[model samples]
Target: MSKRNFNKMDDDQIRGSSRVLRSSLAKKGGHLDEKFKKRKMTDLDPRSSQVRNQRGRLNQTKVKGTKSLAEKHVSTDAKKGKQGTKTTVWSIKDKHEYKIQLPLSVDTSISWITGCHLMDSGEIIMTDFYNKSLKKLDRTSATVTVCDLPSIPFGMCYIGNNTVAVSLGQKLQFANISGDMNLMQSVDTDHYCKGLTYHDSKILTVNDNSVFIHNYNGKQERCLFTYDSNAYFQGIAVSDDGQRIYIASWNIGLVTIDNKGNHLFTLSDPELNDPFRLSLDNHGNVLICYPHSNIVMQVSPDGKNEMGRIIKATDSIEWPNSLYFDRNTSSIIVGCGGSAYLYVFDLK
Candidate 1:
């Protein structure tokens, strides 16, 4: 095995890689469709989130594929009331997190992991944009296996039966994670894709302003309402029942939309700057992060209440991104972009 260390490159090799990365981004920028071209890349600034703050409370949730004992939970409460009004009582606390070393097998480039998903089998999968590969971390043996991709990748989600769909810039590539990592199917999108999620048998992807919904067979189904460029949505999360959609907008805060594509509300916070990713715990609450700000927070199901801080800069989170609230394990899995550590937080 090649020597697998975080600092695999000497000074000269690191500098060369840095130059190549900048040039590559510039080349890709020439094809932007005006909307994404004008938007500020909030996630690329590693120092944006610099303040050290106290931790936020992570909302309580049930284990995936199990029953929730909390009666009239957050998801149900929204449906019982008017269109968007929701009263929430959050039962949350500071989560206990421990960083684990993910040894790489195939590549040595600085790992800019953009997405992570914990499978039902307890293995974790992630998309590394810097290395242009997909990696699977086996929890039992602490062994990692890799599958190279055809292009730079973005977000991804777990499709059933040992399969996952990854977001390429203009396409959605589905691959089987069971073995061989065979390319299963590819769905062409209407726009360059960023954040992606699967809900109600439909796949959802985002650009600077619009959310494109696609059918399972790679067909453009329908698009939700397109907000202005200020929306700057890149990360998305859907309620378990697929009724509410939470989009992370870098310019604004979280924007809530209903199933029929109506804008329910846009929730902004002064403390919120450049929100980048969104995930949901099993029970129905939303989880989001500011990569540059180095913080992760939990929000109520209706997108009205900010639950508490789940993680913060004081907790040693640096340039945090590629966040996933793993429903299978009922834990929050975080991959810090450009770092070697993968953090798994056990919810209290």
Candidate 2:
């Protein structure tokens, strides 16, 4: 029957009937604490905040369900704690940066950009394991050259004047950009490597287990330092002035080592999650990328005499693989493979 037809009686009859219904409902189980009563006994009430709260609590107690992430905790304004660095300043949001579309139609799954270095001729030398080639990008002419290599190239760094040392398939390959297609030297090792940088006349490489430092000429390989098993090292960077060497671990945070690879400090903890790549800004601040979370993190220098802010590109990146900070223009470049674009952010 319709509600209007059932309540066709006078107001007095309706009041009396509601009073009797309340009395019957109270006697059955209403006397007990509302919180302790079974939900089945509760009546559906659209305006009841109490019911909503109770239902939320009930769902939280259940273990097997898709849980929603806490929005406020990850919000941009939630917290900006000073970790011996300047407050993080986001200069670019996701999908808001400029993208440089590549003309090469290679359909390889690019894992990471690995390393970026500007040659003496102002060419951007980017290494990638996707095509197993040393790719050269002429920023001025907008031309890209892919050089075939015997194996995968993981990392590249300028060793001396024009020599670049590349970590390729458990070996170090040295080549001079000005010379012919000849390998100056090849240092063989059993360690799985990723990032490469040079400091204090030594070549630093991040192994799966630890960070190793060798002579710039690739003559020797020795363990300068090691971290706990918690850290899966990926990227390595050395300051131009020769004071710091920053190593990016998979998720264990960054370990700042000195010239000898002796641990100077750790920039992150277990709570920071994953850091896939590392780059140094012109001001010596450490720029990091969290691939799983799709965010870029920056850690300022110890002195914190930094003027430029820590900028992040959020919108334009879908799985940001690498980070490169151009000191001349003060622009940061992020390579996102899904979008197949490079995101650039400016910080002042």
Candidate 3:
């Protein structure tokens, strides 16, 4: 059985390379923190931004909410849509969602849906890093199941057949989703495995400032490239043709690289300032999530400029931390941290 070929995250099947990229996301408390939830989810003023003056090839956007994202700051193509940024983009009518944080889990900490993928069956598979588990959401039936993991999972990339690869700090864990979620095997990594993707039967990973490619058996092929080693890297994605690769540079902004490990360009704009995760759309657009600002935006297919904000806080998107685009449904699945539901938007 062949796995679905994802558009954005080779790394979300975010398809990866690295040992040095580090994030504080894995640490969690045993109990829910009501105050922390409110502060993290809604404390940010989503309407607090404006279009910064355009400079060179990219424009700096300081936006707050969806409506206030300043559509004029984007390209001509993105201005055509009032869809992806709002709830109207969904192809499904049912909005009610099953809870991702399950009671059957050992860890009682508040749930955080950190990574996700849309299966060919229109179902969703998600990784709860805080809970140290995987969750399967059957949209049609409205049922959810959870499976425990050996360690905290970071990011996910689909391998093939009903199987996926999960990043576990120092290792890449593989599991099958055909039956009850089960761990199949794991490949140890000398570097801390953070953001990941699968391309051409190879695994690409990133951490610290380096990206590496590996085989399914965990043999390092070669290092792709490195960025400002000092800057933190989070999400990673690869194009459909496996020619272009994108990385979320937390402090700097969006960066694109070629398959041969050459730096193509770096998109540094205020809008992408705190980018967390990266995904791609059917059109080859790079979707980026900014938690502090609470928005989901995208870069044009060429990686030169932006299409526009696909999502804002107004769309019930509060601190969207991770994202995945379902080619089957032409929908974008958003993982909002500390929330009971995952937000879905249609690109159709």
Best by TM-score: 1
Q: lDDT per residue, candidate 2, 1-348, as tens digits?
A: 000111123445434433443343342332223432222111322223311112111011111232221111111101222224335454643232422323223313322365666544656565655444455555555445454444567777765455667887578876554422234556786676667776656677877658777675665568877886757677877665567777777655777777766777776544344566777765557777765456677676642222232432334344455777666655676664333334566655
The digit string of per-residue lDDT tens for model 3 on 1-348 reads 112112212221110110111112221232223343222221222222211121121111122221111111121122222233222222333233444533311323445666888776777888876556677777666566556676677788776667778888888877777645666667788777778877667778888578989786555677888885554677888877678999887666788889888899888886344787888765667888887567777787667786677676566655577988765556678886655566777654
State every prediction's TM-score relative to the real structure.
0.73, 0.64, 0.72
Ranking by TM-score: 1, 3, 2
Q: Backbone clash tally for model 2?
A: 7
Which ranges in model 3 have alpha carbons more than 4 Å from their true place? 1-96, 104-107
lDDT of model number 1? 0.65
**C-alpha local distance difference test of each model:** 0.65, 0.53, 0.62
* Cα displacement (Å) at residue 66, model 1: 34
TM-score of 3: 0.72
Clashes of each: 5, 7, 34
Query: Alpha-carbon error at 92 in model 3, in Å?
Result: 12
Residue-pair clashes, model 1 = 5
Clashing pairs in 2: 93-314, 93-315, 94-314, 94-315, 94-316, 95-315, 95-316
Alpha-carbon runs more than 4 Å astray in model 1: 1-105
